[model samples]
Target: MTDHYDAIVVGTGFAGAFFLLRYLQHAPPKARVLVLERGRNDCKVWQLRNRRTSSLNTEEFFINNNPEKEWLMSLGFGGSSNTWWGGVARMMPGDFQLQSRYGVGTDWPLRYEDLETYYGDAEVIMAVSGPADSPMPRSRPFPLRPHRFSDTDALLKKTFPDGWFHPATTRASAPTGTRGICCGAGICELCPHDANFSISNGLRRLHDDPRVTLRLQATVEQVETSGDLARGVSYTSDGQLRRATADLVVLAASALFNPHILLRSGITHELLGKRLHEQMPVDVCLNLRGVKGYNGSTIISGNGYLFYEGEHRRQHAACLIETWNSPFNYRRAALRAERGRWTERAFFRFMFDDLPRADNKVTVNAANPHLPEVTFNGYSDYAQRGVDRIPAMVDTLAKALPIEEIESIEVARSTSHIQGTVVMGNDPATSVVDRYLMHHRIRNLLVLGSSAYPTASPAYPTLTLSALSLWAADHLFTRSA
Candidate 1:
C-alpha cells in the first residue's frame, strides 16, 4: 500500500515550521498533507527535565567523517528548533550582493527587499524583542520591547558606539501568552523557564491540524521523481520501507540531508552536495576594571556590527560580535575566584563569515548507504584574513573597554551552524534552487532553509531562513485554497 498527500513536507525545523504556518493559511479545507520527521515529538517538559533538547541525537542518521569540524543538529519533530538558542538577525543588503559588491562569492537571486516583509512576518510569529534602531534597515518597530543591556555593555557601548545595538531575539523579554520572561539563564537550548522559542512552545499546533498527518521516527531515504517533476519520497519507518506520493514536495531537511536525499534519488548536479561551510567563531574573555555584568534581561544582550559591513569585506570575511550577558556566561569561573572577580569579567563571541568551498562537501557514505559523509576541508583564505586580524581587533577593542587583562582567546571548533550544501541562484548550472527556493529543474519541488544560503553571514541564520520559508510558501500556494 502507498500513501498520498497534497504535499509532503520533510523535517519540522525553522524552515518547515514557517512554511506550514503560511501554507495552512491558503490550503483548502480538505487538503491532505503528510509531514515526515526523523525524530519523535519530545514535549517541552521532557526536554527541560532531561536538561537537553532531544534524546535522539544527530549521530543516528548521518556519519560525520570530519569530527574535528563540528556540525550540531537535533533530530525530533521540531528538528534544530529544540537546540537553537533563538538569536534572530536579518541578513544585510550587502550579504545578498556579495559578488557584485565585493568581487567574492556568488550573489543570491533574491534581494533583501524581496524578503523584508516576510522577515517582519516571521518576527511577529516568533514574538521577537528588539531595539528601534538596528544595523539592518527595518520597516517598523519590533513587536516587543528591547532587552536591556548589562552594566558592562553600557561601558562597551560608549567605546564602540556605532552598530552596537540590542539584539533582536526569540528569547522573550516581555510577557506573552505562549512564553515566559527571560531570566538571562544561558541554557537556552533547554530553557528551564521555557523562555526561548521552541516548536513545542510556538508552532506545534501546525502538526495537530486535521488537514495534516505527522509521522515520527520516519527517516527519509530519497526523493522519487518522474522526469523533471518530483513525485514524492521513500523512507524507512518501523524498520520497513515505505512510499508516499504528493502533488507537491518540500525538502526542508538540514543542509547535509537535503543534498544527501537528492543524491540518493539520482538527482545529479555539479554543485549539488558541494560548498559545505559555516561561519568561523572565536570566543574572547576579558576581565574589566570594576564593572559588573550578567545583568541583561536576555541571554545575549547586544550585537556589535562595527566590522560587519565595509570595504574590508572585499579582502576579508565580515565579522559580527555577540556580547554574552547571561548568568551562565563563563566556562572557567574558578579562574575568576579572586575577590570581586565574578562581577568584573565580560565575555564576547566573534564570528567571521566563510565562503563555501567545493572541496568541502557531503557525499553518500559507502560504509552505510543510508548515511551522508561530511567532509570539511577548512575555511577559505578570505575568512582566514579575519582570523589573523582577531588579535589586532581585540587590541583595538581593548581601547574601548577598561580591560584589566585578556583572560583567554580561543577558536571554537564548532559554531553549530551548517549550511550551503544546496544554494539558490538564477542560473541552474551554478546553483540548485532558484530565487523562490524552487528547484530550477523540478518546478514542483521546493527546498527550504539555510541550505539555500549562498554565503554565510556572521549574523545568525534562523530569522532569515524562517522568512525565506514563509516567502517560498506564499510564492507557491497563496491562491491554492
Candidate 2:
C-alpha cells in the first residue's frame, strides 16, 4: 500500500524539524505529516563516546571535536544540529537588503521585518538566550534570557571594546539547563551532552502526535515530478524501493542536498545550483602562556563587526570568537603548523561574509549514480575584499589577545555553515523558490531552510532558517484551511 500524507518533509535537520513542529502546531486536525530521514531513528550518542588517543590516530574521532574527517552533515534524524556547536544568531536586517545596499546579490523576496514575528517564535522554540535586543534594527527582543559567558569569554570581552565585542547569545535546541554542565564534549563531532537540540528531539515529541510519522534510514532518491508538480518521493529503505505521496512536498534538506534532489528530479530552475555562497571562515589560534584550557567552550561567546567604507560600504562583516582548543585537536593543529601547514590551533577563526559568485554550483556526479558533488569555482571580488581584510583583523585579534607563542593557523574548507543553493527571490525566472518558499513551477512543492536564502548573512543561518520554516508552515496551514 502506498502511504500518503498532507505534507512530506525531507531530511530531519533544523529546517525539517522546525517545519514539522510548526505544521503540527498549526495544521488542521485531519492533517497527516510524514518526515523522511536518511539517518538512524535515534540520536547516536555512542558514536561520540570513547574518544581516546587511538580514536584520534585512527580518525575515529568526531569531526569538529576530534581530528577526524567529518562533514557538517549527520547520519541521524536530528541532522547537523545534533552535532553543531549550537551557536545560533539571526541574520542582520541589512542582510536581507544586501542587494539594495551593495548592489551585489539579489534582494530577498521578504524583508527582515516580514520575518520578525517568526524569528521571535523560533527563538522561543529553540531556547535562544542573548541580549533582548539584537544589534540589528527591527529585531524583536529574545524570548528567553541569554546564556552566561565563561570566564575566558568574559576576559576577552573586557579586552575588546563594547562595540568591537558583543556577547552573542548562543542558541541551542537542547533543553534549558542542559548546557554548562554538559562539558561541551564532542561539540565539533556530536553534542556529547545531548544538550544540543537536534530534529530527532522534535521528531520524538511528535511520536505520539498520531498526525506525524517519521521514517528513518529512508534515503530519498528523487522527487517524482509529474509535469511541474512534485507528485511523490522515491526512496530506498532497507534495500527496498518505496514510494510515498503527499499533498505538499517540502524539501528541508541542507543547502547541499536540496539542490541535488531538485536537479535529479529534472526540475529546471535558472538558478537551481548557481550563485552558491559560504562565509569564508579563517581560524586563528594563539597559545596563551600558563593558561590551561584557555579555550573554554566550543560555542561562540563573542563577536566583532567591521564595516568597510567606499564602494564596498554596503558589505557587512563580522568575526565570532567561538571554539576553544581541545588538547588533542590543538596538538594536531600545532604539529601541522610546525610542518608549515595550516592547522586549527595557534589561531582564531575569522568568518567573513562573501558576495555570491555564479560559478559556484551543485551537480550530480557523472560516475556515481547517487552521489552529488559541489564545486565552488572561486570567490567573488567582494570575497577577495574580505580576504584582504583578514590580515588586519588577525593583527587586531593577535594584539588584543597576545600569546607567548603563536602555534599554527590556517583556513580550511568548511561545511559547518553553508547556504544558498536554492534561493528565494521576487522573480521566478531568477530564483528556484518564491518568497513564500514555494517552488515557482511546482505549486505543491515548497523549499525551506538556508537553501532558500539568497545571501548567507553575517550571522548564523539556523535561527533565520527556523523562522522561515515556521513562516512557510503557517502559510501552508492557512492555505489548506
Error of 1 at 36 (Å): 0.7
Q: Model 2: per-residue lDDT, tens digit, 429-480? A: 7888888899987989988888887876656778888888889888876765
Clashes of each: 0, 13
> CA lDDT of 269 in candidate 1?
90
lDDT of 2 at 325: 37
- Candidate 2: stretches off by over 4 Å: 42-45, 49-71, 138-180, 184-188, 287-298, 306-347, 395-409, 479-481
lDDT of each: 0.86, 0.65
- Give the TM-scores of the predictions, in the order they appear: 0.96, 0.83
Candidate 1: tens digits of C-alpha lDDT, residues 207-297: 9999999999898898999999999999899999999999999999989899999999998899988999889998888888877777777
Best by TM-score: 1
Tell me the spans in candidate 1 whose CA falls farther than 4 Å from its real position. 327-335, 478-481
Q: How accurate is candidate 1 locally (lDDT)?
A: 0.86
